[model samples]
Target: MNAVLRTLVVLVSLVVAAPVLAAPAADVDLVKQRVAKVGVLRGEFSQEKQVAGFKNPLRSQGRFVLAQDHGVVWTTLKPFPSEVVVTRDRILSRQRDGSSRVELDGRQQPAMRSVNAIMFALMSGDAQALAAQFTVKVEAKANNGWSMQLSPRSAMLGKVFTGLKLQGDRYVREVEITEANQDVTRIHFSGMSETPAALSAEEGGKFE
Candidate 1:
C-alpha cells in the first residue's frame, strides 16, 4: 500500500468503522448527544501499536488539540518527536528538525479532500457521520460510559482493519484499531479539557 494511503487509512480508521451497534436507538442517541457537546478539546494521548511478529509493542505519547471546525494538531513528544496537522483541505507532517516532510493537498487530489472528514467527525462525536461508513454497535457501560464497535463496509478498508472500537464518557477516551495483518493500535486519551472560548493564536496557526 502507498504510504499516504496507509496514513489516511490510519487517520480515518481512528473514527469510522462498520457493522452494527448492539445497543438501543435511544442509547445511541444519548451517546451522540454527549459527544456533540465537545467543541475545543485539548488532551494528552498514549498510543501503543502491536505488530505481527514484533517482540514488543511500539509506544508513543503525545498532546493533541482538536478544533471541531478547524482541524487537529497532533504532536508526538516521545519515542521520536513529530507533528501532524490535519485540516479539511490538507494533511501536513513535520519532523523534529522543523522541516516539512509530507503534505497532502486535498485541493489537488479530490479523493484526499475528505481525508480529515471522518476523523473530525469522530472527534466531534457525530454518530450520523460515522454510520455512513461503518456498521455501528453501541454498548452502554457502567458509570455513564459507553462503548462502540464498528466494522468496515468497504472492501479496501476491510483488507486493513478487522475491527475498531471507541470508548468514552462525556468525551472520547480511547480508540482501538485492529488490523487484518494481526496488528493493533490502541490510543488512550487523558487530561482532556473542552475550552469555552475559541482557539488560541498558536493553535489556530496549525490549520494554516
Candidate 2:
C-alpha cells in the first residue's frame, strides 16, 4: 500500500477497533442503542499524524461515505486530491483524474478479508465482532456520549497497533491510533448526517 492508502487503512482499522468497549454487556448495549442506525452516513474528516520524531504532525482533510453492507468511499480533498474505495472484494486507489492507482484483490490478499470484516463491523456497530479481536474498556460520558480504549488481542495486531481510543455521542466523532512505533494518528469527524438514507447513483457506483 502507498502512504495515503496505508493511512486510510490505519484509519479504518482504528474505527473497527472502536466497538470493543470492555464494559459490561449492558453498557455495550447502551452504546449500541445510542448510535444511529442508518443505511448511509456522510461526513467530513480532519486527520493528523504525529510521527515519533517529527515536530509537526501531517494534516489532511476529507469527506467520506459509509454505505451499510456495501463499503466506504473516502475522498481526500486537501493536501492533494485522491480517493480510496474499499469493498468486500477489493481495495482500489484512484488518482485525481479517476485512473486506478492501485488495486488489491481479496482473493489474492487474505488480509483483505480481515480488513473488510472489521470495516463492515465498524460501519454497522457490531460490538461482538470487534470484541473478538481487542481488549476493550468503555466509559460512559455525560449527555449520551461514550468513550472506549482498545488494545489488540493478538500479537500480530499488536505489532501494528499498540492501542486505540474512540469517543462519540450518537456517532463516532473522534479516533486516536497509537502504532507500535509510537507514532500517533488522530481523526475527527464532523458534518455527519444520515440524510438521503441511501447512497446516490454516483456514490453507489463506486462500490462496483
Reference-based TM-score of each model: 0.85, 0.87
lDDT of 1 by residue, 149-183 (tens): 87775665677778888898888888888888878
In model 2, pairs of residues that clash are 22-136
**Model 1 alpha-carbon drift over 4 Å, by segment:** 1-6, 9-27
Q: What is the C-alpha local distance difference test score of candidate 1? A: 0.73
After superposition, candidate 2 runs with Cα above 4 Å error: 1-4, 7-27, 122-125
lDDT at position 181, candidate 2: 97
Distance from true position, residue 124, model 1, in Å? Answer: 3.2
Cα error, residue 88 of model 1, in Å, equals 0.7
Q: Candidate 1 — worst ten consecutive residues by lDDT sum?
A: 17-26
